[model samples]
Target chain A: MDKYLNSQIAKIDTSGIRKVFDLASKIKDPVNLSIGEPDFGFIPDVAKSLHEAIDSKCYKYTNTWGLSELRVAVAAKLKMTKKSDVLPEEVLITAGASGALDLLFRVITEPRDEIIIFDPYFMFYHELPRMLGANVIVLPTTKEFWPDIEALKKNINKKTKAVIINSPNNPTGAVYPERIIKDIIDVLDPYDTLLVSDEVYEDFIYDVGHVSPLCFYENTILVSSFSKNLALTGQRVGYAAGSRGVLMAMAKLQQYTYVCAPHLAQVAALQNLNLDISNYVSEYKERRDLIYDMLKDTFEIQKPEGAFYIYPKVGDGEKVALKSIEKDLIVVPGQVFSKSNEYLRISYAAPKDVLIKGANILKEVADELR
Target chain B: MDKYLNSQIAKIDTSGIRKVFDLASKIKDPVNLSIGEPDFGFIPDVAKSLHEAIDSKCYKYTNTWGLSELRVAVAAKLKMTKKSDVLPEEVLITAGASGALDLLFRVITEPRDEIIIFDPYFMFYHELPRMLGANVIVLPTTKEFWPDIEALKKNINKKTKAVIINSPNNPTGAVYPERIIKDIIDVLDPYDTLLVSDEVYEDFIYDVGHVSPLCFYENTILVSSFSKNLALTGQRVGYAAGSRGVLMAMAKLQQYTYVCAPHLAQVAALQNLNLDISNYVSEYKERRDLIYDMLKDTFEIQKPEGAFYIYPKVGDGEKVALKSIEKDLIVVPGQVFSKSNEYLRISYAAPKDVLIKGANILKEVADELR
Candidate 1:
């Protein structure tokens, strides 16, 4: 039976994240910090809208692209966030931001096509293109986890099909600055490469505002979801905005792929647009400060500006991560995100008490490693 | 922007069903028979379960394989239905049956690998494998829409990676006999080919009981969904049961592809296992008889024993389908499912009155063509 499996299957093994999760599940009330979703639940108003959709009998498949009203609402939101004239026809509601990336990669990637990603990137930025038989070129970022523009300029060529950028960055919560966004787009201007901007954490910034690559490039594929902002990760609703030709192609592929996103969740996402989530953002920002302050003295780590993670440069991430589990703490090793094995990714999306408990245990474990 | 797309995009075009839908949207209260979903809405009990899932704050991601309880319940159901000892770990919940097929093809298909399917098949049966760069060898079915055993034996070889079969099939409402199901599996016994059984319409049989290919073959990947019997098409929840090795590979692929089925839908599906939906089956059986009786006189068609569709041989189906629109009727041409253009697929999944009206207009259109 294993012989029937393709070569792509051999390239993709179970992620290290799942291994961490399986270990965490065994510990009794472990201070887990490996989750990628918000700790918050659904908003009351969004829940009401979902109930109304159910009551009104919206339980059949919608248009493959999505419900017209939801697409229109998403397009309007993208126009404001991306600072581009996005039309409703250019938007596609997907199962989640993961689904959007899956569709986009399916449309553009071929065997050996080069796709560039900065170090300390999200997991799929490497896995998706590689699974589709594309060559994923990992470039070094600055010590502070910012994109190395010079390396990007040298590596990008005609074979580069797309370059994926996630901000606020995963594993390390360093949000890209507006000037850097412009510089990255300018570098790609010489090629037909697409800028795939993953803004799932757009609403989680602390100090500065979020800058979208779409603001500088019309060929950008902007993907974000209501999973974090509205806390509907289980509902699996997200949107992607891009050029009409590419989006139409994704939609046609979706007709056979996902069919459509969950209609109940699509309705909830429409209502979520009118929500004010400033309170959640404020809460996450305070949690970020708490985790950074507690761990900065024991480890060499940069202060995160956005997202709910802090990457600390610990020696032997996999060894330290495993050692931390014995102390009832769960953290992801940097090897799961990149080639590096000297950093650990600690998610601060849990309650402040959990973060404090987990941070102290992680520090004690690091001291033992030294 | 179109230049950025790969060659696979050009191989796919907008399906003809969408064209019929776009045309129907312009007519006032058109007797639409082109829809592939049930006219029924979500079961009230299932809807209540979803609301409970929402109210109880179940909006985070589940395991990629699905919630353990749902998988257990599905395994038990598969044990009873497939007459095999299916373990809980072998069942994977997906976004829908479509997502199951997508994952299966991604894990098995490679460029130039041969996948065999009977003609007048489900659209995805042809499109999904082809998109994955497989050579789709479409065999011919008998005039009564049964599998031609000789053709199946002739076309299958070592290059044949999988053979797809859909019972109570779409476009043609033929429920395959039990002996045919065994014979199909026996034919593939000599080769290492997998039998991909799509039983999405398993419950709509009016005469003989449903037979699963998994009863005879361990390599059978049996795919079904709650979308039809429970009328939760928009919820996008389904399950596939097969060998542990194949299922584990699919689950790992799903970790990157879908993450998990909508968690809310997974919870509802767990509760839905207790639901008795025999009434819905009895109602559809009546509708199937009504439409077959009305159209058999004017069109060359077989009596549909199961499913909610009647495929009638109309002279130039594309022209007749278009002409029926003027008379406020909508049907799908057979070209979308096969190479032939002489048959139209009429879905009787609508209300009794709509089915009568649509059938009347369809008969008049066929008479005019004659």
Candidate 2:
């Protein structure tokens, strides 16, 4: 039976960072900072709308493409941000951002197709393409965690099918400036390479705000989800917007896979189509500032502009994370996101008091380890 | 971009059956019997549990394998009929049966791995395998739609990685009896082949009841969903139970794909852990009896044993269905399900009055055409 199984799945096992989380979950009270989701719940009004939808029999299957209203809502949101008239056909409602990535990779990449992935990338981007028989070519970043556009230019060959760019990146938490994004697009402009822009944390930016790659690249597929922004991770609702040709392929592939996201969740999402995140942004900024105030001098860390993560330089993330665990403070090692373990990712998406207490504990551990 | 697309996806267009459905929806007041979904909604207690779950703030990501309670409930249900000590580790909650199939096929099939699917099949069975670089060998059935197990034996070889067995089948409401199921298993037992038993319509049987392949086969993955029995198609929740080795591979692959099923839907399904399907079964029986009674004399048709569909041989199903459309009575052409257009699939899963009207119109068209 084991021999009959897909070998690629066996190739992907528990990451080192996952083991840290596993050890941390065993503790009764760990000041957890490895949370991927935001501390904020759905807007109060939105949750009520979900209840109303459930009572109104929103449980029946919508169209396989998804509820027409939600698709329209996704298009509207894109128009406001991406500054493009996105038609409903260009949008495919997915299980989440993860779901969008999965379907897009399946439809676009052929076997031995080279995909350019940045180092210090989101962990999911690693094995997915390789499993689909695509060859992964890692593009390492400089110390600043910005895209080395020259390195990208050197690697973009005819075999290169797609290049993934995750801004307000998971581990690094570095929101790319407009100039840097334009440089990356300029390097990709010559090639017909597909740009997969994952902006799941679009609403979570504290400074300078978010920008759409759709503004620069015609070949870009903007993948985003309501998981972090709307606190709907568990509901598994997301969407992908791109060129009509590419999206048509993704929608066709989705029919054979996830079918569609949950009907009731789609209906509820329609009620809160516009993101109202003033309070949420303010609260997270306070937490981010509090964390930086304590550990900023201890480690070579930058003040993050977006997402609920801060990746700081540490000698050995596994060792630091292990020491932090001993003090009941759960922090993830950077090896989860990249091949290197030189940095550790700390998530400060928690309450004010908890962050204050956790920061003190984290400072003590960092000082002791250093 | 079309040239750069995965050629398999381009080959598998939106289904012809789907086109028929699209056209049928425009008719203002057709006596519809072309539905694949059950007429009943979710169990009364389950919908309440879902609302309770939402109020309790259960809308966060569950473990990728799924909620422990739902897994336990699934294993418990299997223990009753399957007579095996099924464990939660062997069960993986999926997006739906379609999702389970997608995951399983991706993992098992290498390029050109041959899969066996019986003809007059559920339309979903056709394109998926072919898209995965697997050759779909359609096992042609007898005139009565019983599986040609002898024909299946001739085809099973080293390259045959899997074979799909669906009963109380779709389109044709022929329930495979225990003896027939046993014969199918006997052919499969020789090879290290996987048996994917789609018992989604298990609760819809009208005469000879459903049997589990898990009762006979060791290498079987029993794929069933709440879509039909519980009427939660829109929710898209289902489970796959099988050998731990295969399921572990599926669970791992799911992490990069769908992530997990919706959290609220999982909680809702827990309330109706045990099947209370007698009422649903009885009502479907009445509908089945009425349709069979009316059309038995009018056409060449078998007295269907299970499921909502009744396939009767007409001169040309396309002509009969088109003529029925003129009368505002909707019945699907059997060519949608099979290569030949000799039969039209009549769904009896409608209300009493609707089925009566649809059945009478069916008789009128059949008599005049004959």
lDDT of 2: 0.83
Residue pair clashes in candidate 1:
none
In order, the first chain's TM-score in every candidate is 0.97, 0.96
| Tens digits of per-residue lDDT for model 2, A1-370 | 4856755566564566568978897899878888888766666766887788777877676766778888888888788887867788788888899999998888887888999989899877888988887888888886768778889989998898988988888877788888878888887878878888999988878888677788678888999998887788889888998788878888888877788888878877777778587788888888888888878888888788888888888888898889888888888898888888888888987887877777787778778976
Query: Which sections of candidate 2 miss by over 4 Å?
Result: A11-13, B13-15, B367-369
Report the lDDT tens digits of candidate 2 across residue range B290-359: 8889888888887888888899998888888888888888889987878778989998878989988998
Q: For model 1, what is the C-alpha lDDT against the true structure?
A: 0.88
Tens digit per residue, CA lDDT, model 1, A59-109: 999988999999888888877766778899999999899999889989988
The i-RMS of candidate 1 is 1.4
Q: How many residue pairs clash in model 2?
A: 0
Classified by CAPRI criteria, candidate 1 counts as: medium
After TM-score superposition, what is the CA distance of residue B195 in candidate 2 from its true location, in Å?
A: 0.9
Please provide TM-scores, in order, for all candidate models, with all chains considered together: 0.98, 0.96
Candidate 1: where are CA atoms >4 Å away?
A: none
